[model samples]
Target: MKLNLILFFFCTLVTISWAQSPNLSKYNEEIKKIEDTVKYFEVEKINDQFYMLIGGGGNVGVFVSDKNVIMVDNKYEIIEEVLMSSLREITSNPIKYIINTHYHHDHSDGNRAFGKMGVPIISHENAKVRMQKVTQLYGGIYDFIDGFVQDKYPTEALPIITYNSKLTLSEDGEDIEMYNFGSGHTDGDSIIYFKNANIMHTGDAFVRYGYPYVDLNNGGSIKGIIEVLGSIASLANDQTVIMPGHGNLSTKQDVLDLKKSLMNLYQKTVLGLEKGLSYQEIADSIDETLAADPVMPGAELTKLNYIKSIELELNN
Candidate 1:
């Protein structure tokens, strides 16, 4: 019996140690290999000073000024080094600021790496709060299925500067406006506008990713996103260039089109719910309507989640 207890104790200690720190060397090496690939990230020149870095995560807005470079969003930390290397090809200016559109990992995961370098990270107050805690994404739809868990950001990863509604920064004779019209993709979504450049980064609040994913679990709603989209459209003109959270660069008309599509889905959800239809039934109806629309893969599941979010909002 004593020998068995000793063996059990040894196994327990090993298990504890492994749990505390798992071996990730192989994982790290594999990820490095992928990151080192040249086509892992793509950069599109917006103009002389502004550019958009696509892939490796959410779209990164690179605004180069004479003094420093301001990034609208930094993708995952795993790609931080490679991302910086790509930026070096554009400008040698040091990164001055990183404005997080929201607290989602894809959009703000590099906060720790940049913040440690003394870069001032800016985000909406609510986003800062959300980042400080573990965020369970996709509402609870995947609670028993395949759920996405966003770990809590460390103090260094949290935004150093936070704004309530609107904050304007004057840099290189241009006004960079950050506005939080309300909760959309997340409670802290920021719509960034470069006044002089005539360019806008609509973060996740406005994405080209077929159907937008609302973080209903993190204070996001279909109605809120719809409203924010309209506000962003009003702020743009024919000359404005839109850099969405994901997908290719867009225009004001595209924003309006997205808004209309979401509005259509929102109305359909409401109507289905009023008629006592099940969530799946509503989603099916939505899916049929969106059959002609361009959507990302796995849109069927996305539509179900979208319908659930709208139903949640109406019920509340």
Candidate 2:
């Protein structure tokens, strides 16, 4: 009996460790090292109330008021010290609200750190549900799908408040609204708008990165992206400053251009599917002109990944 109990306990420990490894082995070593060497973070002031925190997993939005401060996305856990230091440069008010745009670690990994400091984190209901199931520290294909072991997240890292469609926050004169664009980047993807500032923080749904990854396993689809992008473009005007999940800040026109490119891809995929082409065939027969469009600018591998995601989404 004693021997059996010892074996059981040993196995449990090993299982837990494996479940929470966070796939450090999968990251690019050189890029990770470069990001690590940066001791400070840069903040770009969008206007009087909104600021963008650059150089992390995702672009963080910092909104300041006389009484309180609000944040959108906290990047990674490794970014804690520098993120906090950068926030201090803007204001010393308490961080009243943290809006997590999605469940991806690059955007929400710092939840544990911020939660410990007593800040309330808010996210779409599905984001909270997915975060509860996430075991790894990295949010990628493996974590989004079923390849890796999933360990439960620490209580501190989970979002405390969750909304179904929309939630609005009033900070001084600025009205911050959070809107959920269902099943685009993830089941719980959200887009944040600083109404007074005329700035939109488009989570992973609209990124400046080469090709956006559609988390098909997590209820993401290219069709949903098409709808979401159209809605986003319609909501903006010439003056709206768009803040993407990655890359430099952009304008409304850029978002529209990306939408056009994605629409073209979606049409081509549909056409190929109608002709009964296999995934490989469809990928191989990509419209070269559309693929080379400047709007997307994603690498071949990234585009291929998107193609795979689209195929999976369509088949299912």
Using lDDT, give the best candidate's number: 1
lDDT of 2 at 123: 95
Q: Local distance difference test, per candidate?
A: 0.82, 0.77
Give the TM-score comparing model 1 with the true structure, all chains together. Answer: 0.84
Residue 79 error for model 2, in Å?
A: 1.9
lDDT of 1 by residue, 1-316 (tens): 9999999999999999877653435334534654675355687997899999987668999999998999999987777887888899899999888999999877887887888778899999999999887666764322222255676788888888899999999889889999999978888999999998899999999887677778887888779999999999999998899999988899999999889988888888888889999988877776453321242446666677667767667777
Query: Each candidate: how many clashes?
Result: 0, 2
Q: After superposition, how far is residue 270 of candidate 1 from its true place, in Å?
A: 1.1
Identify the runs in model 2 with alpha carbons over 4 angstroms from their true place.
Answer: 1-35, 135-151, 278-298
The runs of at least 3 residues in candidate 1 whose Cα sits more than 4 Å from the true structure, single-residue gaps closed, are 1-39, 139-146, 280-297
TM-score of each prediction = 0.84, 0.84
